[model samples]
Target chain A: MARVIAREGQERRVDGIGQGDHLCLVYADDAEQRRVVTAYVRAGLSRGERVLYFADARAPREVLGWLRAEGVDPSTALTTGQLSVTTAAVGYLAFGAFDAHAVAQTLQAEVSDALSAGFTGLRVSGEMSWALRDVPGADQLGTYETAVNAVFAGQPASAICQYDARRFSAAALDDTQRRHPGTVELAPLHLNSRLRVTPSFRCGQRMLRVQGTVDHHTIAAFAATLETVLGWPGDVWVDLGELEFIDLAGLRALAQTAARLPAGRRMHLVELAPLLCQVVNLAEFDDISSLTVTARDAA
Target chain B: MTDPAGPRLPSSRRLTHQALIYGSDEEFLAATVPFCLDGVDQGDSLLVITTAGNTDLLREALRDAVNKVEFLASEEWYGTPGSALGACHRVVDQQVAVGEHRRMRVIGEPLWHGRDAVETAEWTRYESAINLAFAACPAWMICPYDTRLVPEAVIADARRTHPELAVGASTRSSPDYVDPAATTGFWERRIAPLPADGDGDAAVLDFDADLAAVRVFVARTAAALGVSPDGVGRLVFSVNEIATNALQHGGAGRLTMRLAGRRLVCDVANPSRRATDWFLGYRPPGPGQERGYGLWAVRQLCRLVEIDTSDGVTTVRLHVDLD
Candidate 1:
């Protein structure tokens, strides 16, 4: 039986990912993509899996260079056929058109080949920027992504579909995220059964995206994440769009963070649920000079 | 003897909890209108919370001076004693922060008609506890009790709760007043015990450290009992806060949950026999303050929260109306 990877609908670090897991890697920029892809390929090679990368925006040579710079020698694996770096033109669009079923079949074939060739599993990651180029039948990207899950089902194979947020529309990103079983997040600042706190820096703004519940049990981790995010220079933003619930202790943590911010810095909380908004307002959090809260737009 | 003008407020820069007992609307105005006008002249922020009819009476009587006085219906203002107190504290805090008002003069007539004996007693305790909750603040609050509308027993309790009484322009120190500090036992009086739990009718869980389980238990049980989604959320939040406090202060706790009529009552009890401050959740924590907000927020979220420290345990019962 194929071993299950990270729990479905939860976030996993690049290294925690395993065979039978299908993940979406949404990168804000090249730095983020390089970090995740490097860790992912390194982990795969170390685990004796056949690792493959279909480079789109970056040349295959550049992708190899990133691995080498990260202290991983890809030349030996390249010679042994355990590592392969190709281009989307030669792999996904080999027939001069995108086909969801064809690609899924190809993926299944790769998994079988890797298993037959004395490898433990097949680990593949593809730069999905090709879908943004208006390729014929490229609109079926979500369909292809969804179909890939079936190929990975009960098979020794895993895939990470990387989408550059800068290149993908918000709707496209959201759709892809929904289709994937799990997302690759930065090694989370905090993760437990009750709450998950992940930090990301985009465009000079540091943000912590909190999901699950934050009550007294998880408040210490949540508070520590706030402290780490607040340590970064400039204003901090917390995205509570995915947050299910936050109690008074969590609110107090936000208030304490705002109180401790240096002069001229503020904390912006956005996409709050209506109930959380009501609590924040009831607690008079708005009276805190360095704090700002924006409720999620009603559905 | 009292000044014909109206009640004379004390000059001390501290809170004064007073009662205004009146028989008619004219008498109510005779005592309140001049009090509000004088507050306006003194640059004090005035907050009048009364019945709609009385609000109209005060508005019509205050005339142009009405704008200076913020009016809120008593029904809306008195959700729970703790929440009402929290709201009043917020108003006073804001006024103090602005530095524009010399004092806060509030004409608060608590809703008395529909309350059961338990609720009336709690509200009465609230009236007395306000003295301690706002001891240092410059606020003069007069709670009016209508002779015709208020039950005689409640009016009698009002004298014990209020330090001063105003009866148609005659202001005097209430002979029956019991100082909150001197009667700390009265303030921490044991709340009525919850009825014995039915075999399987109540969902009970004992929690020592994991507040998350407490939340899940509450959300599930509340929803199972037919609480609306929003109500479930609130009950979970409130219960989690109380449970957190219990674990932190009392070491471990047990939760008993059951539905009484249309209300979902959850009791969180701990082994500690220590007396709980009656004003525990009645005051908001100041900025940068961390320890005092949990219970305050719980009180704001629940319909009514009663903290009882008797029978060798401290029980904080949270009530949420399922309807």
Candidate 2:
């Protein structure tokens, strides 16, 4: 009976996700996908829920391997029928088509079967790229996603719809994002009313993406995030493409982080707004050898 | 008097602020051309901020030596007293860091033709402040005041502001000179009050401990007044800094915003009656210094920033010109 709704401009943590929550995860790359999938599967299995994954971009064995790497033993669950991993072709595009009502019925049946089998409920995750294969009625993916909300409503069932940002068109991503009530984001290093600092690892690079304002009210969060990111191995990159504002205190936090970086490791600031670029330059942050700033052209 | 090497003004390792009063083109060139050439001879980095006419005259008079000096028009350089102070500090700091120059010599002529009473007073305060703001840097600045074009009252104020007065080839200590520490308090005591919000059209917000709401109020209000996106960004930044200070230092505050002609004015007032420093934001913080940057940045971002404390309330007024 747990329902989670992510407010606009906010994201929900994967661990805090509950039954009756319909979440969409737009992953930047394979590393990010593996991390979230492992956490989601582990969370479900620990709670005795029947965990299901419909893998499209990754093989079923590869998905299980991620669970094993994250210290979750999927073998017992797989053997006991408490966990299932299949291709999206078999699970979603069954019978050569995707119909919204049919998918809703299929999801409801799974939830019912899990309860009858003595498991707590059902937790499902599907890699959504298979819909792009031109299968019959595949264009109804949005309809299916929206319809499944009712299938999970007041029921012990939840879902995570995964879309790879690299392959999906902007319109598709936007359409899918609006159909879900929540989004699965990694547990942020920091979050407050005015700012969100979410961390991600892609292509072996640690990154922190900042969104919203970083001023006196939010400098503590921003500074703390920078401190956490700096503690990680290798160089760090902060993506500020969605950042609406950052003040002197925020800049000071960045400077302090850059200064604290060990020799040979640099803090890379990418997609900085033009106004912020002016502020950084005025602060003379360029003097910090460990820091590099690149301004994204104004849209 | 036509030594071509300029008057041998006192050369101090510390800052030397002088007023060069000239009545005619001959006198202006006679003082400035020699000042530039002499600074160049002494390996000092030279910057000349003056009227377009004076820039041309100095350029012609210096001939080959003019290339060694950086020239900026006064209208563009003197955007506000705070900004002008920031600009001068940058020039001096850059020169000092390069180690290629012994000192920085500037010919700064403030724009005074179209200023109101408040602006005139602020500019006069700026002249006084240069004495303290650059007291540590090896900068020798000459503020040129044209007797015919500048108001007689402003010309009189200049004598009191500048520690040294230069007329043609003669240089002498100005008996009218007042120390910045003394004048700063005097100016603050006599600081002009903002015009009455007579129309009741001004947007007002009472804020306490909510810096974010303060920012939103300023941004929306400035945009409603037709401030450009960039202008709105700057206004929000400036106002947010002041409001944050108000909340932290004064416990709470109120904000009033109104448009005066094409310029947007925002005043943040708090009940804390502590004496505010008139020169708080003039000097930039040193490298790696954490505090004191908020106010400095506010001055840099806004068109004009005035701090007034009177009648049991302290107010920080910020102005931004709308596009």
Number of the top lDDT candidate: 1
Score chain B of each candidate by TM-score: 0.90, 0.90
Compose the digit string of candidate 2's lDDT tens values, residues B1-323.
13221344455677788899889999998888778888889888898999989898889899899889999999899998877887777777678778898888888999999887667887888898787677767788899998999999999999999999877766799998987667346656434444542233779899997777888888888888889999998888788778888888788899988876557888899987686777677777776567778878788788777888788788888888888
Candidate 1 — what's its lDDT?
Answer: 0.82
State residue B139's C-alpha deviation in candidate 2, in Å.
1.2
Docking tier of model 2: it is: acceptable
Scored by TM-score, the top model is 1
> In candidate 1, what are the lDDT values of residues B10-124, reduced to their tens digit?
5657777789988999999999988899899998889999998999988999999989988888989998887788788888888888988888999999998877666787788
DockQ list for all candidates: 0.40, 0.34
Worst 10 residues of 2 chain A by lDDT: A1-10
Tens digits of per-residue lDDT, candidate 2, A34-100, equal 8788888999999999998999989999999998888888889999999999999889888678877
* Model 2 quality (TM-score): 0.73
Summarize candidate 1's per-residue lDDT along A82-139 as a digit string, tens digits: 9999999878998799988898898899999998999999999999999888799898
